[model samples]
Target: MRGGSGHSGRLLGEFRRTPLLVPLSEGDDGGLMTGWQGGVRWIYAFTDEGALARFAQSRGAGAGTGAREWEYLSILGARLVDAVIPTVDGPTGVAVDVADEDASMLFPPVVGIVADAYAVDAGADRADAV
Candidate 1:
């Protein structure tokens, strides 16, 4: 959701309330596995175990020598957007159910989806005016 629309607001609300499974990278820190696209970094969140499984499989996790279960962190969408996204460097956002094309949702780093300080487009108007 790009933000600033009723439908996008509702979708963001629902996403905030949902429980998401976020994959963790293997290491001491076990940080979140992020993706970069459209000049924005994305934190992936799955609706359920099945969704996560699909994503892992697509990444070749269970194929050939790469077969292994993914480690994950269970978190609410709100915490991801409100707390986590802010800590990341540069522009970041949440990607929900990404493996499922029809069910996917993207909460981009815009005014409403992120804090004003972190939003890439937050000061766009002022910049243009300058």
Candidate 2:
């Protein structure tokens, strides 16, 4: 248990420090968001690992072909992720786009993208609390 917790921490830290461009692809998780304004396919340039960890966990990758449990990152450099959006009504997750960017450096082979979305409640429910 201790090792698992420590690893997550390490991963979280690594994600935050690396200036990597994570390409997010809407997976089959079935996000709840609806009627968004922009493209769902987004290129989130995050310097925060904690957010990245959250994104990785949300997909429920289920330990792919590897020693790592809950493996999300594929050797191909692109992983599938759920697309969640905050609308006027509430938070919803689905397949979407973010309009292609000229971020050639952020593309595959150079950088890796763990496709996933915001797992936690993106709605008012989380704020309401237990």
Candidate 3:
């Protein structure tokens, strides 16, 4: 458990420092490409263009065309977790490097990963008060 906790801290710090590639929605008014899983809204971010391309391919973005271009915004992980996540309603989290099984990381909508006000498990600390 200690090692796992250390790993989480290291990973979270690394994620906060790295610049993530966030894909934009295809519309005149571009919005973020997000999804819901287990009631949590996830904002997908890739570590690099290769990672993004792999994800896009897996999702069949272009299908038979074999040539699909995706629009993206490069934002630091800190801003995503600190600024963007708060603006979004409900529990929101960032999913990083989703295409790579070994490299993937999930910044879940928990007390440590998000603002206390937005964290799904914000009250967990209080549970220990008893």
Candidate 4:
């Protein structure tokens, strides 16, 4: 997966479309924001690494304050893998092979993962303080 050092704004935008797993902490760069999603904490590092490092240090005194939110995404990635297992049989209950096996398996898992991620993110935010 891509590192979270320079895509904070894009990450924030992505998270905003879905519920965040944690409260969003904005950095001075204005483009970056850290938040949680799907029982995972993330560092939306939009700017360069230097900027994000400063932001993490700024938030003083917390057990998991400096954690990156992308860690949670990694967990979701595994779940996504599970959700994409191929189906042996077709809709007609006939034995058949499909060319785009991976894509077919991915569809439901992708949807479920997104939904679950949103729910978990919202729930985590409500339970904890950013």
Q: Write the per-residue lDDT of candidate 3 for residues 1-130, one digit (tens) a residue.
A: 1335556677788888999999997778687888799999999999999999888988887556566689999999999999999988888999887888877778899877888899998876576645
Q: Give lDDT tens digits, candidate 1, residues 1-130.
A: 4334457667878888988999997678779988999999999899999999989988877756747778899999989988998899999999888888877778889987889999998977775544
Q: Could you tell me how far off, in angstroms, the CA of residue 93 lies in candidate 3 after the best superposition?
A: 0.5
Q: What RMSD value applies to candidate 4?
A: 19.2
Candidate 2 has an lDDT of 0.31
* TM-score, candidate number 3: 0.86
Poorly placed runs, candidate 2 (over 4 Å): 1-18, 21-37, 62-130
Overall lDDT per candidate, in order of appearance: 0.86, 0.31, 0.85, 0.29
RMSD of 1: 3.7
TM-scores vs. true structure, each candidate: 0.86, 0.22, 0.86, 0.19
Candidate 1, residue 44: the lDDT equals 88
Q: What is the alpha-carbon lDDT of model 3 when measured against the actual structure?
A: 0.85
| Candidate 4: count of backbone clashes, pairs at least 3 residues apart or interchain | 10
Better of 3 and 4 by lDDT: 3
Over 1-130, each residue of candidate 4 has an lDDT whose tens digit, in order, gives: 0242455445434333432121233455342133443433333322233333343455542237565542212112323223312221111110011112221111121222345433224345444443
lDDT ranking of the models:
1, 3, 2, 4
- Model 2, TM vs. native: 0.22
RMSD of 3: 2.9
